[model samples]
Target: MMTIMRNTKLSTRTAAKEASHERIVCVAARAIRRSGYDGTGVADIMKEAGLTHGAFYAHFASREAMLAEAAGRACAEAAAAAADGVASVPPEQALTYMFHAYLSRENLEQVERGCPLAALASETARQTPEVRRVSTRYIKEMVDLVARQSPDWGQPGSHERALVSVATMVGTLLLARIADEPALSDSLRAAALQHLPVA
Candidate 1:
């Protein structure tokens, strides 16, 4: 019975620690999205997480380390959300869903909670080498995921197609956000979607 109690206690502790780490990642992701990578500071993330600066070292080696993990997590969450939204549709329909959803006004207004790559790409270029490397890997992973959803492409030159799709979507979102005009944002989404080939 004593052994069982000790094991249960250990398990609870481990679970709590993991939950804390996840919280830190989530906080960092939001901060990075809102303020860009360079604009967000470690102290700020820690404060937002309700954690101390010293506790940050327990979760990450440095801010660059945290950024690397946060980038991957942010990308994975966005991709997973996109995948879930189109899971039941055919590949062609899935692509359409992704394109429309990405360029939609709802997505544009929630930049901090939307695609991290689109939110942080410009700032990521100025980050540490590790952050840049991780960001590159995450972008490639996202591109590959989208490419796999292209029914007409059949893998050949799919990467290029994915690049074009991502570039167009991100550009549209960025431009719409910068313009800050509701009608222009709607027009941008419509125009961008109109150009995508229907499979």
Candidate 2:
């Protein structure tokens, strides 16, 4: 009976530790998305997560370790969201759905919870080797997804179209974030969507 009770207590502790780790990742992801990679710090993430700085080391080896995991989580969430948008649409309409969803005003205003690549892509180019590699893989995955939805194009054109589409979406969102006027943000989205190839 004592052994059984001790095992139960250990299981509860393990479960609680796992839950705390998940919460840390969730809070870190949100902060990184809202404040860019370089802008966010370990202390801030821990404080925001209601965990202590020392406790962070218990969960992750370093800030970069957490960043890589957070980036992966963010990518997965974005991919799921994008997939949700395209799941019900026909293959031909996939581009329309993706482009429109990506360039939407709501997405633009919610960068903290939007596409991970677009949110910290510029900073990603300068990330640690592991982070850059993961970012590269994420980009390739997105391109493949777009290609799957665009079967009408030739091989070269398919790849080109995917690249162009992603580039346009990311570029437009970045520019929109920088522009001083709300109209300019709207114009950026309009121009990108208007110029994209449609089926």
Candidate 3:
């Protein structure tokens, strides 16, 4: 019985550590999107997660590792949200729904909760290989997701169109957020939405 109690205690401790690790990752993910890679600090993330800064190393080997995990988490959340956005729509309407939702004002304002690609594209370009790798993987996944929404998904030009579409979406969002004037920001999104081949 003593041995069983020790094992049970160990299991409980491990579970709690795993939970805390997940909490840190989740908080860092949002912070990166909201503040960019250079802006998000380990201390800020740990404090926001309700964990002590000293405990951060216990969860991650280094800040870069945490950033890589956070990037992955952010990208996964964006992809899942995109998938959920169109899940109930008719097949032909999926791409249109995605285009409009991505350019919506809500997405424009919610940097932390919105697409990481739009929020961190420029910053990710300068991050370490691990973070860039995670971003690149998700970008490819996003392109495929868009391509699948095309009626001619497997046909020629479909993949190319998806690439262009994704670029346009990301670029537009980036510019929209950068524009100081609210009118320009709104117009940028409107123009992109107007030109998007929302089938």
Looking at model 3, the pairs that clash are none
**Per-residue CA lDDT of candidate 3, range 66-182, in tens?**
999999999999999999987879989999999999999999999999999999988898999999999899989889999999998999999999999999999999999999999
lDDT of 1 by residue, 1-199 (tens): 9999999999999998798899999988777887888788888888888888888888887888888888777777787788787786776688888888888878887877898877886787888887778777777766776787787566667778888887888888777877867888789889999996546
Ranking by TM-score: 3, 2, 1
Report clashes for each candidate as comma-separated counts. 0, 0, 0
Worst 10 residues of 3 by lDDT: 190-199
- State candidate 3's TM-score: 0.98
In candidate 3, stretches whose alpha carbon ends up further than 4 angstroms from where it belongs are none
TM per candidate comes to: 0.87, 0.93, 0.98
Off by over 4 Å in 1: 1-9, 155-158
Q: List the pairs of residues colliding in candidate 2.
A: none
Please write out the lDDT profile of model 2 over residues 90-180, one tens digit for every residue: 8778889899988998998898899878789789988888788777888888887777788665576888888887888888988888798
**Most accurate candidate by lDDT:** 3
Ranking by lDDT: 3, 2, 1
